[model samples]
Target: MQIDIRAKGFELSPALREHAERRLGFALSWAVYDVRKVAVRLYDINGPRGGEDKCCRIQIALPGTSDVVIEDTEADLYIAINRAVDRAERSLARRLERQREHRHARQPVVEITDDDSAEEFEQRADAGVFH
Candidate 1:
């Protein structure tokens, strides 16, 4: 997966970038096949004031589905990144699970007998016309 990291309101350091990349790679490794790209935005929401204002927003682009976006805020940037990555992993897993369920939930095809057509059988079943 292609990962893009952006920092706002502070300088992006090599150590921070490496840490974020490593964490994201590890967290999202299971979804690499589905995920096309990942965008990570780190920022100091409170600026020099420093509170629980370090924010990490992660957006994952998946093929044939809506992108997953996760945001986390904490006092430390690493914590925020970790939380956001974890949330992203969970969200992606849920999405994939739902897709799999939907794919498997399709109605089974039934062969029509000489006495009844498929449509008629369905209609009868809908009208509670079982024999």
Candidate 2:
């Protein structure tokens, strides 16, 4: 999966990039579908108190399904990113389960052939020429 990190009004450092990549990778490893790409945007939202409000928004792309987005705000960007990624993973799991259930429900059932002895059955059929 490709992880694209974008920082708004701030320069992304190597540490932040690595942290976001590692955290998102670890969190979404169990996803059922191939995450085609992940977009992470970090921004500093203005607060009334003049303190920087860190926000993280993550969009996880799933094949054959809609993308899941989760956003979180915290005093630390890393924490916000971690929380958003976790939420995205949980949402994807739920979506996958629902999709699986829907597909299974639409499956057609086939009858099973219970005959265990095929040779005997064929022999009996052949002998029916006498009957």
Best by lDDT: 1
Stretches of candidate 1 off by over 4 Å are: 107-131
TM-score of each: 0.80, 0.79
lDDT of 1 by residue, 12-93 (tens): 9999999999999999898888889999999998899878999999999988888999999999999999889899999999
State the weakest 10-residue window (summed lDDT) of model 2.
108-117
RMSD of each: 5.5, 7.4
**Candidate 2 local lDDT, residue 99:** 84
Residue pairs with clashing backbones, model 2: none
RMSD, candidate 1, Å: 5.5
